[model samples]
Target: MTTAAPDLAAETRDALDADVAALRRGATLWTRLSLDQRATLLESIHASTSAVMAEWADVAATSKGLPPGHPLRGEEWLTGPYMTLVSTEWLARTLRTLAGGGNPLDGVRMDETAAGRLRAHVFPGDLSDRLIVSGFTGEVWFDRDVTMARARAAAGLGQRTPDRSGGIGLVLGAGNITSIPVADVLYELFASNRVSLLKVNPTQDTLVPVFERALAPLIEMGLLRIVTGGGDVGAYLTRHDEIDHVHITGSAQTFDAIVWGVGEDGAARKASGRPLLTTPITAELGGVSPIIVVPGDWSEADLAFQAEHVATMRLQNSGHNCVAGQILILSEDWPQREAFMDHVRRAVAATPSREVWYPRAAKRLDALRDAHPEASWSDDGRRAVIPFDGGAADNLEVVEQFAPVLGVTALPGLGQDFLDTAIAYADERLTGTLGANILIDPVAQTRLGDGFERALERLRYGTIAVNAWTAVGFLTPALPWGAYPGGTLDDAPSGIGVVHNALLLDRIDRAVVRGPFRPFPRSLTALRPASRGAFSLLPKPPWFTTARTGASVSAGLTRYRAGGGLLRLIPTMLNAFRA
Candidate 1:
C-alpha cells in the first residue's frame, strides 16, 4: 500500500491565500463592528450551519474514511455544528454585554481586605453565576482580579486606544478535533477583537472546506482567514512580520519549537535567556492524562458503563486527542480490579479497529509492548489494555504510549496508598498535563477526600476530572483548558497558560477538580440495542445494518428536525456525556 505525497495545487494555494487575505480584512472590520453587529453575524453563521447539519456531518465523515453514517460521523453533527452554535451564541451574548459597557464579570464580587485575605461571591441570577457553575461540582470561581484586568485591557483597547484597534493574531489549529481551530479563530476575532490567520494542520486538510463554509460569514464580514500547508506554512505565518500574537493547540514539543526555535542553536539561545525570536505564543498542549479508579462496590452496570466510558475516551478520533485518558491508576487490593479489567478488555475487543490518524501510533504501541512483553494484545490494533502486576512503575511503557493503548498500574493497600501511588506515578512519570480523568464513587470521595484533594494539588496535570474523563472538560465551553498553571520555562511538561472559556480570565493556567455523576448505565455502554425498531433511527448506531443505515439515520435526523430544541439536545448531550 503506497501512499502518495500530498498535492498542493496552485488553485488550492490561491484559494487559501485569498481566504487569508479575506480574514485579515475581516479582522479589521470585525474590530470596528459594533459588538451587537458582530453578535448578529455570529447568530447568522450558527443558524446557517444548524440548518445544514447532516450535510456537514456527511462531508466530515467521508473525509475521515468513515461511512456517511458512522457514529463518529455524529461527532460532526453534535460537536461541530452544535458546539459552534452554543459557543457562538455564548460569545455573541458576551459581546453584547461588552458592547453595553457592562462587564460579564461585574456581578462576581471579590475583595481582599488584608494581605492574603481573599473573599469572592457571585450575585444570584447573574450570567457569570450561571456560566461558571459546573453541573459536575456546583460552583467554580476564578481569580477575579486577574479576570477583570484582562477584560479591562481587552475592552479598553477599542475605546481608549486608537493604535490598538486592529490586533493581528495567528491561530495554529489542532489536527484532531475538527471544531478547535475554528473555535480558536472565532474567539480571537469576536471575544478578543484580534484579526486572525488560521494555520491548518497537515493531518486535517479535509476539514478546510468545512471551516471555509462555516466561517464564510466572518470571511464576508472581513474578520477571519484560513491558510493550509505544513511546517513551512506554519512557520511562515507564525514568524510573519504582521502577526502580533499567537495561539496554538498541539504538543509541548511543537509549542517549545515555536517559542525557542528548534535544534541545538535554539537550545543554546533558550539557555542564554534570549529567545531566538520574541513573539508571545499561547498554547494548549498534550498531557499524560490519568484515570483514577477509586475502590468501590460497583454494580455490573457500573462496570459496563465505565468500561465504555474509558473506551470512548481512547477510541474517540482514534485516540489522537490531546485530552485522551492514557493511564489507569487502580488499587491492586481492590476486589473489583479483575472485574474492571475484564469489562475494559471486552469493551476494547468489541470496538472495531478504527483508522489510526496519528502516524507514529503503531511505533509507540510497539515500543510500549517491548518494554512490557507480558502486555495483552487484541487481534486488532485498535485496542491495547495492559495491566501491570505489583512492580516498579519506572518503565517507558508505563510512562507513555501514544496510541489506543492503556497502561494499568495497580497500587497496593487502601485509601492513602492508592492516592500516594497515583501522585507518585504522575510525579515520577507522565509527559504532559492537558487534563486528567478520575473515577471515584461517593464512598471513595468521602473516605479519600482530603488525600485525593492533596493528590490533585500535587498532580502536575492541568485539568482534572473526578469520576469522569477529562474530554468532558474540553467539550464543555464553561471550563478553561490548557497546561497546568505555575509551570515555568525550565519545566514544560504541564506547558504554560490556559485557553477555552477563559473569555474574561488571564491569570488562570490550570483547573483541578472532581465530577459527581451517577454510576454508568448499560444502555449507554452497549453498541447494539436489544430491539431493532427502537434505535433504527440512528444511522450507523452500533446496531445499524450498514445497507439500511442511511435510511435509519435519515429517519432519526428527521425526528430531530421535527422535535428540535431541548428534546433533541438533551439526548445528544447525554450520549456525548456517556461517550
Candidate 2:
C-alpha cells in the first residue's frame, strides 16, 4: 500500500502567502479592540463554547473509540470548550481590571523568595475557589532579575498599550489537549498582542469548525484564523514571510524539525546557524517529568490515598500528558515503601483499560517495552510499569514515554538528605525543565521547614507542584506555564516563552502549586464523615478511569456552563460515585 505524496504545488504556497499577508494586515485592526470590546468578545466566546463542545466532543469521542455521550466525553469538554470558556471568563476579568485604574492582584498574597524572585500567590482568588479546591493553592514566581515594583507594573502590558503595528503569529497546535491550541491563541491575541493564525493538528483537524464557532468574535474581528492541512502546510507557514513569530505544542523532535530541517540536513543547518525557518519560536515541548515522594512514616490509609493520587496522574489522558509523571522517584529507606508500591499496583490494576487514543502512542509504548523487557505487566493488562532498581543515570531517567507506561526508581536517604538527593536526581536526569511534582507529609514539611521551601525553590522545573500533579499549575489561568525562562533559541530544552498568563507578567520564571496531601472525595484518612461530604460540590473528575459515574457529567458541565446552577450540580454529584 503506497501512500500518496503531499501536495506541494506553487499555487498552494502562493495561496498561503496571500493569506499570511492578509492576516498581517488584519493584525493592525485586531489591537484596535478596546479592553471593554475585547471583554465583550470573550464573553460571547464563553457563551458559544457551550454549543461548540457538543459537536467537538462527538468527533473527539468517536476518534478515541468512545460513545459520544459517554463519561469519557468529560475529557474533551473539560480540556476543550470548558477550558476555553474558563479562559475567556478570566481574560475578560483581567481586561476589565486593566480597563479601570485597578490592578488584578488586589487581594492576592505576595512574598519575596530568598533567591530574589517575587512570588505571587495567585490561587484561592475567591470564596468559591477556596471551598471547591480546599487546601489547594498556587503561586507564580517572576524572574530573579525582575523587581517587585516592576513585576506589578508590568502586568497587562498588551491592554495598557495596544500594538498598532502588530504582526500575524502562527500557532502549531497540539493534537492531544483540545484547550492547548485555544490557550495559545488567547496568549497571542491578548497577552502577546498579535493576530493569531492557529494551525490545527491533522489528527484533530475535524474540530476546526467547532473552534471557528467558539472563537467567532475573534474571527469576525479579524483577530484570528484557523487553517487545516498536514506537515506541508505547517512547513509552509513556518517559513512564510509574514509570520513574525510562532508557538508550537508538541515533541522536542518536532520542534527541531521545524526550526532546522529534517535528517542530516537539519543537523548541518543547526550547526551552521542557517536554518530554513527564521521566525522567532516559543514552544511547549514534552519532557521526562519526575514525581518525588519524600520518605515518611505513613498509616495504611496514607499509602492508599497517595497511591491513587500518583496513579491518577499517570492514567490521565492515558499517560499522553507531556507533564504527566513519567519517572516516579521514591525513598528506598522509607518504612512504607513496599506498602506504597503495593497500593500503587492495586490502584493501577483497579483502573479500567483505556484505548490508546493519542497518535503514535502505541509505537512509543512498543519502543519502551522493547527497551525494557523487564516491565511488569500487571493485571487488567491495561498498564505497564518498568521498575528501575538501577542508578539515577539511565535511559529511563531521561526519555519521556507518551504512553501508559511509567518508570519507578527509588533511592536511599531520609528527610532533607532524601529530598536533596531526589531533587538533584530529577534536576540532572530529567530530560527537560518543564514541570515536576513533590509529595511530602505535612509533618515532614514542617521538620524540613525552611530547608523544604529552599529545596522547592532550588528545583529547576518551569512548574513545581507540592502534593499535587503539575497540571494544576497549568490549569490555573493566571499562572504562566512553560519551561523555566532562561533557555536560548539555539538550544531550548523544553522550548521557550509562557502562556495562560491572564495577568500578563513580563518576566515570568516558573509557577508553583500546592495541594493538600489528602483532599475531599479521596479522603483516605479523613476521620470525620462530614469532611468527605464536600465532594458534593462537583462530580469526581470524569477523566479518571475509576470514575464510573453513570450520568453524563460532560452534559451536566455543558449545561452548567450555559447556566444550570445547583439544579444540574445535584444530579452530577449523585451520579459520580456509581463507579
Candidate 3:
C-alpha cells in the first residue's frame, strides 16, 4: 500500500529542467496572477511545512548526533521552519503590494553621503517599507529610482538599463542552515521576479524530501526546483546555458572556485586577467564574527544576559554557522574582565556538548589547538573556551579558531584605544566579516557614538550587531544579509551580495548594525543551564516561563494567524514592554 521513493538523482534532474523551462516561458504568466493568489500559495506552503515541524526537528537532531528532543534541535526547528514561514508570509504580502503597481520607492528620498554610501529615507508602506519591519539595519532605495540613478551616475557608471522585470536565477545554497536555500530561492523568485534552480550542498542531502514538501506549491507551479548531490550537479546547473543570473550562500573558497574555476589552470587564468569563465556570480560567504563587550557593564543581570548572548552565538549549530561570534573582544582595564570571564566559563560549562556536523570539524579544531596550544579545551574536546591573559600579543589564542570554540582577548585602556584595537584585530586577524557582535552600554554608546560608528564603518564585516548577538540580525527577515560594501574579486570578506526576506528586493552591500536596548532574555549566545533547558524545551515549550521565548513569540507572529495587526502585535508588544 506504500509507494517507493523515486530515484533522487533522476527526480532532481527532471525538476531542474522543468523549473528552467517554466521560467523561460516568460514572466507574464507568473506575474499576471493576483497578489492574493501568490499569498494563498505561500500560505499553503507554510501550512504544509508546519505539519512536519516535529519530523524536521528529529531529522536535524539525528543527523547532528544529538540526544532525542535536544534543545539545539528545537532551536534549528524554530529557525528553519517556524521563522522561515513568518518571513515568507511577510514577503508574500509585500510582493502583493508591489504587483498592484504600488511604487515601492514612494516617499523614500535618497542622498549620496560619500563614495560608497547612499542614505535613503523610505516612506511607510513603500518599496523600502520592509527596512524598518524588524531589527534590520541599512537604508533601501529602488535601483530604478531617480535618486539611485543619480547616485549611480555620481559613482561614474554610465546610463544603465533599469529593467524592473524579473528573470531566471540559480541559487547555490549553504549546507549549514536548512532554510537558507529556500529563503534564497524565495527572494529571487517572488521578490525579484525570477525562477530558481536551487543547488543543495552535499551535507544537507538528507533534507531534500523536507524541501520538496515545503516547496510543493512552487514545484506544482513549476517555479522552483530542488536538486541534490555534489560538485558535478552544482557545476552542471550553475553553467546551464539557460541560466540568467546566479546567487550563492557558502564559503569564499567555494565562491572563488565557482568564479575562477578550480586548480592551477584557473589560478593562472585569474592572474592573467582572464577568468576560467565569466559569469555573474553573487555570494554571501563566511566570517570569524566578533563580539565587543564595552567596559562599563555592571549589573549581574546584564552580565548573565551578555554571557548567554555570546555563548548562544558560538553554540548555535555547533559553531558551524558563518555568523557565530568566534572572537570576544573586551577592555582589559575595565576591571570587570575577570567577572565576565568567570560568568562566561560557567555558561560554557553548563552547555550540553553536541557533535559538530560539518565535515572535518574535528580536524579544524585540532589544527586550531595545535596552532594555539594555550587554548582551553572542554573535558571532551567537543568544545574549546580559550581566555586570553591581558599582556600578551604573540599568543596563539589571538588567532582565528574557526570551530566550536571561542577565543577571549582583552585590549587595555578605553576610548579610542579600545575602538582602534578592536577594529585592528578584526581587520588583520579574523578570517571573514560575515557577522560581528558589539556590546556597549547606553552611556558609553552615546558618548562614543561617533567613534563607535566610525569603528563600525571601519569593520569589514557584513552584519554588525550592537549590544546583542549577531544571530538577532540573522533571524530578522528585514535585514539584507551579506557582506560589507566595496568587496571585490581581490578581497572576499563578507562574501558578496545579500539574501533573506524576499519582500524588499534590496541591493545593499554593507553593514547591518542592530542596536538592542538590552541583551535578549533566553538568548543562545553563551552556553548556560538556561540555554540547555531552552534548547530541550524548545520543540514544545510551556506557554509560560519558556526559555525558547523567541519561538513562542514567533508562533503568533502572522496577522493572518492572529486575526489582525492588533492581535499579532499584542504578544510582541508584551515582550517589548516587559523588556
Candidate 4:
C-alpha cells in the first residue's frame, strides 16, 4: 500500500482545478456546437493532426538541434505539423462556409486599396493555391472603417450573436513556433467561440505529448486543456479565477508580466495604469523586423538572388523569428550598395550553422557582440554580420537582436525619392509593427508606379512581404497575424490582437504579400531575361536556408498538405527540383 506519492503540490492544484472545471463546462458546450458541429470538429482535428505529423516533425526537429535528416529539418516540417495542418485546413474551410449558408467571403476576390482600404483577394486559394505557390500573392486589408456591407456582415462564425456566449480562453503559448500552440489552439477553439486552456510554452515542453495526441478532438470535447508548468504555471494561469480571456504568444516582457505585477510591483503597476490582470488581454509581441532593399537595375543574378533572400530573412528560426528580418534597409544612393553588400556577406556565409536555439541564445549573441564591436563574426559564435554606419543606426534600431543577428542599414534616396525615404525609415525607424519586407525590382516596381502602391500604403506593418518573407505572413492561413492595429493596454507596440485569421476576419488592416523575385529556373529569368518582368515555377523556396531539398521538400509538403493525393505531388515535385 504505497500510495503516498501524490502530493506534488497537491497534484498541481488538483490538475489546475480539473482544468478550470473542464474549461468551465466546455464554455457552454463550445458555444453550442453547430456550424456543422464546428465543421465536424475541424475534420476531427484534421485527422488528428494528419496522424501525428511525423511525430510532430520528429519532436520539433529533436528540440531544435535538428537531428534526423536535417536540411534544417525543413524548418521542423514547415513550422511544425505543417502549420498545424495549414491552420486545420483553413479553419475547416471557414466552418464549411458557415455551415453552407455560404459567405466565407463568397468567392472571395474584392478590391480597393490605394489606401482607401478594403482589399481581400486572399492568395491563389484555388486550383490548389495555383499548383502550390506558383507566383504567390495574397491580400486582406480592411479597416479604413471597413465597409462593403460591413465586410459582408462581418465574415465567418457569423460574427457571434444569438446567445452563443463564448468564455474560458487563456492560451499563452508560442515557445518559438511548433505551430504556435496549434495556431493558438485553433484560434481559441474555431475562431473565438472560446473553451480553451493551452498554456504549454515552457519552451514547448516536448510539445506536451504532441499536443495531447494532436488535440484529441479538442481534448475529448471538454473543449481543450493541455497544460504544463513553469513561471509558476504561467503565474497560476494568469491569476486564475475561471479565466475569461487572455491570448498572448509571448514577450513584451511577458506582456508586462501578465499585465503588470512582478518586479517592483511591475514597475508600480506599469506606472499606475493599475492592472494586475483585469483578464482581457491579447498579444503577439516581438519587433525590430524591417528588410527594405529598393534600389534598381540589378543582376549579378539579381545580386545573388536577393542576397539569398536576405539570408532567408535572417536565418529563419535561428533568428528566433518574431518576423525575423532584423533590419537591412539600404539605399544610400544605391550604386548596388557595395555590390549588394557583397552578396550579403556571401549569403550570411552560406547558411548552415544553426542551433543556438532560442533561450538566451548565447546570452543574446553576447549582447549583440557587446553592441557591435566591429561586428561580422561566425565560426559558431553563431553568426553576426552587423554593418550600420550612420550614427550606427541607434543601437540596431531599438534592440531586438533575437540572434543570428543581421542589422545592415543605409537610407537616402533614388527611385520615387528612394521609396519615400524607405517608407519613412520603416515608419519612423523600425522597432516592430510585426512584419515588413520589400526587395522591389520588378523593374524597380515598374519605376515606382504610384510610388509602388504608395510604398505599400506608407508601411506601418502587420504583414507586408512583397517579393516574399514576412515568414510568408506567418505561413499563411489566409493571413491576419497581429499588430499595426492600434495597440494598447499601456503601449503594446507589437503586442495586440489578430491571429491566424482564416477568414474569420472583421476589421483587419494589413497583409499584402507577393512573391517571385526570382527562383524557378531562376523564375524563367523573369520571362526570357534582358530586363525585368516575372513568371514562376516557384522553386528554391522550401523555406530556404540555402534550401537543398529542405528536408525532403518539407517532408513532401507535409504529405501533400495531409491528404496525399496525386502521388504527393510526385515527391513534392521531385523535392522541389532539388531546391
Q: lDDT tens string, model 3, 262-375?
A: 899768766876754355667788767778787875678667656766777787778788877787888888878888888787676666667866888788888767766776
Question: In candidate 2, what are the lDDT values of residues 1-579, reduced to their tens digit?
Answer: 002223577777666666676677678786677888888888888887776777876777676666654555566666677667667777888888887777776677888876657889888676545543456678888877787788778888677787454488999999888889999998988877788888999877878878888888778777787888889888878877678889999988889898888899999999998876777889999688888999877778768877877877787777788878888898988888888888887877776556877887788777777777888775444477778775646776777777877789988899999999999988877788999999987667768877888888889999999987888777778788999777665677788888898777787878988876654455443344433112222224454556665326645655565555665666655564454
Candidate 1 residue lDDT tens string, 1-579: 001113455575456556556656655665556667766887877766666655666665666667854545554454455556656655665567777877655565554322222223321223322222222331123343544465445532232322244477888988777778877876666445687778888767776777777777776666677777887567656665556788888877787777777899778877887764466767777766777776888788668767776776666666677777777778889998889989888877666555665778777777767776777777465557777653554443234445777777777766767777776776666677677777765556667655665666566666777655676566555456777666655456655666556244444434544343342232222223431111111112221111123233333433343336545644543342322
| Per-model TM against the reference | 0.79, 0.92, 0.78, 0.35
User: 287 in model 3: Cα distance from truth in Å?
Assistant: 1.3
User: What is the total number of backbone clashes in candidate 2?
Assistant: 0
Q: If candidate 1 were superposed on the true structure by all CA atoms, what would the RMSD be?
A: 7.8
How are the candidates ranked when ordered by lDDT, highest leading? 4, 2, 3, 1
Comparison by TM-score, 1 against 2, better one: 2
Question: TM-score of the candidate numbered 4?
Answer: 0.35
Which residue pairs in candidate 2 collide? none
TM-score of 1: 0.79
Cα-based lDDT at residue 360, candidate 1: 82
lDDT of each: 0.60, 0.76, 0.62, 0.80
Which ranges in model 1 have alpha carbons more than 4 Å from their true place?
1-27, 105-163, 388-400, 449-455, 487-490, 512-563, 567-579
